[model samples]
Target: MNTTPAFSRRSWLQRTASGFGALALHDLVQAAQTPLAVKAPRFPAKAKRVIFLFMSGGPSQPDLFDPKDYIKRMHGKTISAPINTNELRVGTDKFLALATHGEVKPRGQSGMMISDLLPHTATIADEISLLRAVHSDNNQHQPAALQFHTGVTADVRPSMGSWISYGLGAENSNLPNFITIHPDSDTRLYGASFLPAAHQGTKVVIPQGDKQSPIDYLADVSGDAKAQRARIDFTQRMNRRLLKGAEVDARMEGMIESMEIAFRMQSATPELVDISNESEATKKLYGIGEKTTDKNGRACLLARRLSEAGVRFVQVTMGGWDHHGNIRDALPKSCSETDQPCAALIKDLKSRGLLDDTLVVWSGEFGRTPWSQDLSGTSPIHKHGREHQPESFCTWMAGGGIKPGFTFGETDDFGFRPVSGKVHLHDLHATILHQLGLDHEKLTWRHLGRDFRLTDVYGNVVKEILA
Candidate 1:
């Protein structure tokens, strides 16, 4: 008798396929569980955290940091446009030299040039390393900001914070590794394109009113902790089942991980955000209750708190620097809104002994032109504003591995191009990664059959600015 027992189709398939499925499932579960867990750096790190104070809409470099006597003397006069012959010129076709809005005097022992508009920042000039010739490729706001955050000016890519989060992971398991406070409307600025979604920046807002929550949809409406847990468990099981069948779905895997994080954050985040317990003196230092500095002050204070609590990358976006017209009247308002809060953050970090390992960077996407642009063509020289200039800008870095009480880079007499120590956006990205113990060349993610990096195959670490 051919005594082989009749094998059912279901049993045969299960027996043959179950082992492979189990192995895949096990790997997926492990990854989902520890996606944000802290990872060892490739080398010794100088900075444990990064606080990027992004001045959106490009601040004016000439009016703020790199003032030129030539430009001031030739104010309102049509000077020879040093712009590239190939480049397009619009409102700035006249190339009329624009004077600084106020005096740009030497500050601190380093003689870093700072505007009278930023009095608070001037006081801490000794603590900063000023880069006078930071340049980017784009002149437009959206594209320039994109380049600043994602390395590329056009295509969507992982943001700098996302990359850092991927490289270092979360120091505090209860919080996200990357947090962007009051970010721009563009989600691409914080998105973790192609990389694991868990590495993306978590958007946070400083509550304006007593009733508002810093993060929306954070409250549990079910009001039953046990019941919520049960629902989450059920959802996770289904997600895992789907993942196991698919073998690999990065999006689904990220969803699984993010859901768990959201659940946990409900319990851990509220206390961290609450500022009622903060001392009055500390609040005053940040200008928290004051009218002019209230919004950014709260945001900056929150950034410090988040960083101190082990968040790897924290960003505070302060907008309204886009002074296309009437810059003389507009620039000081912008400076007043941001100066004190930003300076206070530096001081607070130093007081807490966090400054040594905390990298604080202040910059815009690009700087404004030294030439005036009068849209009406009838406006006076004082009323005419500057145009965008991508050739050169000013950026300042404090703490981390930077040389304090020093200035690096230089601009030509026109303040239109870098004469020396030119640091491109790529170089800036590379240097930031280097300070965090990440090799820019080695810290890459494979996407679309090739490796991609923050510097995008072009960047040299600016070693001269390093301490």
Candidate 2:
């Protein structure tokens, strides 16, 4: 009616923004063109995949990696220690002294002091980079666990694995870029909040006992392949019709992509989880047949298989580490449930030549207190367990860019707090991203009119731990 061709919104934006809008348009075009295809990293990548062994609850560090001989000296004495929070209400002034439960001896050529409780892990001590002074802002379990996965504790955000998946995309198109096996009940642990849902982890819960089906309803039971395809096609047509007038939503696009992935996964996921093809020796290696180790062993073995099959990130969680009392019996059982399988995972990865490019991380939410909860001079074996100590803890990394057999950071004589080389959770996230050739500062997503990153606004790559 105006007798002139109408200027498109994109054209109007480009004409009014003094050329800045063109750059924004270019970025949008690039993002659309290469949504999830494998792309080159910003720099050379050392690790192609990651296997995170998340130990839920807290594990005491003094009895594990950072042993304190001085704690033994003042075992039953009341010592003045710093308590930063009023939540515990233990009065920051003085607390009862507690000593290590087991002997901590030098392991491997690195001469790192590892507890006797983790003898299996100690065997591969030379393959790990132990961070003795790892600390977190939160001491509580859910918040700390959230902080470990996402940078913030208060809000639902994309996880580190999700960030990696967003950055690297899926290696095997049939498999998801991020996979979480036997994760905690909390879905936030592997959720991709603001990021595209395609990057969200595909969760696979391992059956606890005697149940073999890893994913229920994975296979089509209709027994007619052609009919199933026709049904899927019809459903997709309806979805497309619904999507026709939407504002080019990424979430809807991601949902469509996810549906396609699920369709493809029908053929791929079954083979990935099936361990029947694994050798008997391999099963024994992972302690799959043993009652004490079977659950976690299956998880670790599945993680290995997934990693081998080119899944970008795989997380395996082992819970029940929160020991407020009776740590003597509780700690050993925790170790026994996980130690053999974890060690076997590393060894299996190495033997299969996948360790070089597969980075493995092992850590808990926080460390335990240096002092006991109760002051009564009880029996040595029955002494009350330590409380949560967020000020200092330890975590380890192996393979890829990590320096083998290295122990970085330090804690005080009594393992009360960090003395030097304190590695914050943000820094750890940054370092992990760096090892994968992603710059923490540059790997960002624009959300809520601001750039959000996995490390948030804070992170320093711990170069000292790099190989």
Candidate 3:
């Protein structure tokens, strides 16, 4: 057996042409060969790209997005009674404090109240419409996460991304329609159930350590231009030979096309991933080249770069939003890492006039419980800890026809349930598609002898959330 210091996944796949990254390489190797169909939107499309700020764990609506301190003080005597006389209610022995120390100030002419942790996002308040009352069915993480993306709380379904990619064929046939990046080098968020194999996200790069560039794998050496082309051409002959007998197999076709695209993307993506070309001020605005916001900021900047490059949808995730314990320690770090990049992405899109045609969503699956799990009202402060609260949550949208700086819906005095203008995960999904020029109910695929859609069977577009 060959005694080379074995292919330890990264070194093998990332370095040599035939390396450990075979599975990942295979996705690209097959991209061009697949014959996929596309369906146009029902109306004129306003946005060409979508960027999602996925807070892996949830953020507390009461403590972060929805302010209920006034209600808590007004009903100081009746704090134990039901805070909300609505369809949903939460048990309470509550002591609420905004996770960040700064004031919950209003921004833009729209008077949107944003938490201080997101200083960068605050400046772009006029560019966003804050959805303050998003509710989910699952309290647990896995199902809730799947629910947030697929719109089905329990049953299996295609994720919104797969559906989007299926409906809207990629803008740049050379690059993937859906791309995801992480700050922590984790990769557990993407899957495609029954949709076309091409609908799944192709992770061009994965997080390994210390905010490494997200485009490294996509970069190819410039030294051997002719040699590389000759090698790729020769390999294609072999791949084509294999495809000769497999005319009925779509996977072979996809693999053949993907290989060509991969070779092309190796040259294109590095430019998109590099932020150094951006102005120093722009980098600082994005928290790039900064001593502090290295992790979260990096992903945010890359999202903008990818969007502008004609990618259909880009998701940048900064986890650790669970706030289960040591939130005071954990939340701040994650928020700080993310805030500037979040704001910078919005600002960059707006300044370039792309914001009006692009959709930006910032959200967590669920939220933290309103009452402190560790601290009591009597205590001034305590160690970080928060239990799951799916009753209420926060998510915001900017551009792509969404209202700006306007807060929609409400929660109770203790900030637990939606009293008015309640928005469910399904409703939010419906609204997102509506803005993108697709009727959620109409966008469907046949599977298991039934019509399948991103919103499942229940969702009405929250018209009030529209710009």
For model 3, how does the per-residue alpha-carbon lDDT over 47-152 read when each residue is reduced to its tens digit? 7678888888887555556766654354223334343544332222453332433356677787788777767777888778888778999888888887887776
What tens digits encode model 2's per-residue C-alpha lDDT throughout 196-312? 778888888886554455765666778787888888889877776765555345576567777777778888988788888999999999899899899999999999999999999
For model 2, state the Cα shift of residue 101 in Å. Answer: 0.8
Which stretch of 10 consecutive residues in model 2 shows the poorest summed lDDT?
1-10
Q: What lDDT does the true structure give each of the candidates?
A: 0.87, 0.82, 0.68
The TM-score leader among the candidates is 1
- Tell me the deviation in Å of residue 358 in model 3: 0.5
Candidate 1 wrongly placed segments (more than 4 Å): 1-33
Model 1 agreement with the true structure over 313-413: per-residue lDDT tens digits: 99999999999899999999999999999999999999999999999999999999999988888888889888888899999999998889888999999
Which regions of candidate 3 fall more than 4 Å away from where they truly are?
A: 1-39, 70-102, 154-156, 183-188, 204-253, 375-381
Q: Give lDDT for model 3.
A: 0.68
**Preferred candidate (TM-score higher): 2 or 3:** 2
297, model 1: CA deviation in Å? 0.1
